[model samples]
Target: MKRTTIIALMMLFGISFSKAQTSPTAEDKIHSFVSIKNPPTFPGGMAAFYKFLGENIKYPEQAKKENIQGTVFVSFVIEKDGSVSNVKTVRGLGAGTDQEAERVLGLSPNWVAGTLDGKPVRVKYNIPIKFANKTAK
Candidate 1:
């Protein structure tokens, strides 16, 4: 009786421990940017990040011709595995600029995942992309 009781308690304790220490999952809650200890980063930091945006984002011909310029705020989740997902434009200037911004952002390579309490976590990130024609005044 004593041995059976001890084994049952140990098994119960082990199961609870495993459940509590589980890592974040794809459907797991996303941590806000402000709460992250180490925020996610592009492969080469801000400069490289901007360079990538510049190289990928193309100004719409119509927008360029009409001189429609503004900043597009893109938001997404950087997953614990460094994959980009849920890309969206929070604020956009319409007229193809919105679609272009989303497209370029979706093309981005994986980033360094953010961390909280020293463990990798999914983080919500936002970036403002400026759309300015060379001739914009």
Candidate 2:
């Protein structure tokens, strides 16, 4: 009985230890631009980045018809591998503009990952995408 109890306790302890090892801790969730030494950037500089957005982003038909015009603020995480994820709209305009902004960011290419202490790390990034419609005079 004593040997059996000891074995059971050992198994329980081993399972708990493995669980702890696999679970993410507070430190593991520490991806933020505030703590990073350098923030992520697109392949080119801001000028080129804005040009890319203008070219790739499509004005939603509904938004265009409704004459919706405003800037959509998007927030996303740039991973250590330079891939983007967790895209969300912090501020949005109606008439499908919010969805369009998210779509454009989703289709963006991998950026230069942010760095912390010169080591590549995930960082949070925010950008404002503008939508405007011009009618003939």
Candidate 3:
């Protein structure tokens, strides 16, 4: 009977230990740009990010034809592993800029992960994309 009780207690402790190991803390939480020690960055930095945008951003023909010119604001999460996800346009000009902006962000390469207290953490980031007809309109 004593041996059975000892085994049961051991199992309970083991289960609780496993649960403790999996429990999340502030370190696991997604942090805002201003809150983290190091904000996430494109691999080469903001200049590189803009260069990538200029190279990859495609102006929708509909937008060009309509002379739609404005900025789209996109928001996304940089995960702990530096992957971009949950991309969305927070504000946008019509004529497909919203969807285009989201698509461009989806094509983004992984970023340098943000860190808090010297450990990697997820971060929320935002960017604004400007569009112009640029065709003598």
Among the numbered candidates, top TM-score falls to: 3
Q: What is the TM-score of each candidate against the true structure?
A: 0.76, 0.75, 0.78
Could you give candidate 1's per-residue lDDT for residues 38-115 as a string of tens digits? Answer: 999899998998999999988998898788988999898998899889999999898789899889888989999998
lDDT per residue (tens digit) for residues 1-137 in model 3: 99999999999999999999988887667678888769999989999988998888999988988889989998999999899998988998989889988888888899999888788888998889999777833
Model 3 per-residue lDDT at 9: 100
Q: How many backbone clashes does candidate 3 have?
A: 0
Query: What's the distance in Å from true for residue 22, model 1?
Result: 20
> lDDT per residue, candidate 2, 64-132, as tens digits?
788889899999888888888999999999799999888888888999987777778778877899888
Question: In model 2, what is the error at residue 97, expressed in angstroms?
Answer: 0.6
Runs of candidate 3 exceeding 4 Å displacement: 1-28
Worst lDDT run of 10 residues, candidate 2, spans 25-34
TM-score of 2: 0.75
TM-score winner between 2 and 3, please give it: 3
Relative to the true structure, how large is the alpha-carbon lDDT of every model?
0.88, 0.84, 0.88
Best-fitting candidate, measured by lDDT?
A: 1
Which residue pairs show backbone clashes in model 3? none
